[model samples]
Target: MTLAVLLLVSSALPAQAASNRAKQRKLTDTQTLFTKAMRWGEFEQAWSVVDPKARESRGLTGLELSRYKQVEVTGYSEIGSMSEPDDIVVRVIEMRVVNRNTMAERTLRVRERWRWDEADGQWWLQDGLPDLWQGQ
Candidate 1:
């Protein structure tokens, strides 16, 4: 009985590890796509990467998108990331933004919160959107 149990447990480990690797790959791909969208000023396209719950609650608006048009993302880089409980990943992103009208530039750090949605089999950004004009 002991040997049989051990055999079953050992057989499951590799499958579990493969699943983890796949999830990690998906996360990396999603992050890359999101970063590119932001850098290129594709706010609408970027919105698709946000969590559905966030979208439903915050709801992207025309005024909000207009604000993005007022500024251009000059640079975007991920400073660091950490994994949290409940399959959550938090990342610190540094962005160099320039005001289109004034041509003034500013560096801002934004914290991005991502959570793994089991039903969807993917990760989602819990934070609705980056408020680039928050204190401007």
Candidate 2:
């Protein structure tokens, strides 16, 4: 019984590690895609990457997105991330934007919540950008 239990446990370890690795890979891929779209000023592409539910409710008229659309993003940096329940991760991103009419340069800190959607078999942005126009 002892040997049988040990064998079973040993076999399960590799399976568990593989599952974790897979999840990590998916997260990395999602992050890369998000970073690329955001840094390039592809707001629509970024919107496409957001979770369907969030996108539906927070469409073009959403405060978060509307605020972003009002400015021209020059650059961005991924500063921090925190894991959340339900396979979600919140990321703190800093963006450099130039005012559309005034051309004033400012740095904005935005928070994006990302969630892994099992049904879709990938990660999705759960929340829209925070008040990126603050302190501007």
Candidate 3:
């Protein structure tokens, strides 16, 4: 019985690790998308990653993202995250941005709630509006 219990515990560890790795990947993907879009001055593309549900709830239009001009992301750090089943994850992402023209830089700490869509098999940032570049 002891041997059987040990085997079960070992098996569960690998599965749990796999689950954690998957969550890490999804969070990384979110930061990657944001970094790539902002670095290239592609605000529209960045908007594409915003949660559609959030857009509707917040009454935000895609045009709102146009407010940003040239931006370069210098740092991205995941400060917090929460896991709820396989479909709900919330993360606080901290980033440093530099204006391409002014060369001025500031750090924006944003709490981004992410939800995993089973159909899409991916994650979406729930806040939609990151409140980025405020007073920067």
Candidate 4:
């Protein structure tokens, strides 16, 4: 009886472990993509991570684009990550940078949010601070 119980427990362990690993990988991948997008000033690419409905509702365009450009000018340095299987957040230590024409540095902090996209089988941004899904 003890042997059978042990066997059953062992059998269930791998699946649970795999699921956790998958979730972590997804979160990491999302962070990497976001970092890359920021590094290159890919505002449209970054915006692609926003939930479709939010995109429609917010009508993010000119103002958002300008803000992203400001972020690009201030290069990002990742400070840390606060993440779970389903949600991942990154804190960036920013330094204000001159747009290829001058040289300067200023201090700032930027927080980004990420969440798993079940439908797309990937992870994506949850939009700006305060996140889209807060109460539920």
TM-score against truth, every candidate: 0.96, 0.82, 0.62, 0.68
lDDT per residue (tens digit) for residues 22-114 in model 2: 987998888788778776767777777778887688676666566667777787788998998888888888888887778899897888888
Compute the lDDT of residue 124 as modeled in candidate 2: 84
Q: Write the per-residue lDDT of candidate 1 for residues 15-101, one digit (tens) a residue.
A: 999999999898999889889999999988889989999999999999889999888999999999999999999999999999999
Clashing pairs in 4: none
1-136: candidate 3 lDDT, tens digit per residue = 9999999999999999998788679767876786577556677777677778766677545456545655676776878878777567777778788877889989988777777776776678776656666644
The 0-to-1 C-alpha lDDT of every candidate, in the order given, reads 0.92, 0.78, 0.73, 0.61
Q: Whole-model lDDT for model 1 versus the true structure?
A: 0.92
lDDT of 4 by residue, 1-136 (tens): 9999999999999988998799777777766676676667786776776667667777666865664455334566777766555455544444344443334444556566666666777766666422211232
Q: What CA root-mean-square deviation does each model show from the true structure?
A: 1.0, 2.7, 4.2, 5.7
Looking at candidate 2, what is the lDDT of residue 13? Answer: 100
Top candidate by lDDT: 1
- The global Cα lDDT (0 to 1) of model 3 is 0.73
Q: By TM-score, how accurate is candidate 3?
A: 0.62
Scored by Cα lDDT, where does model 2 land? Answer: 0.78
Q: Candidate 3's error at 135, in angstroms?
A: 8.0
- Stretch of 10 with least lDDT, candidate 3: 60-69
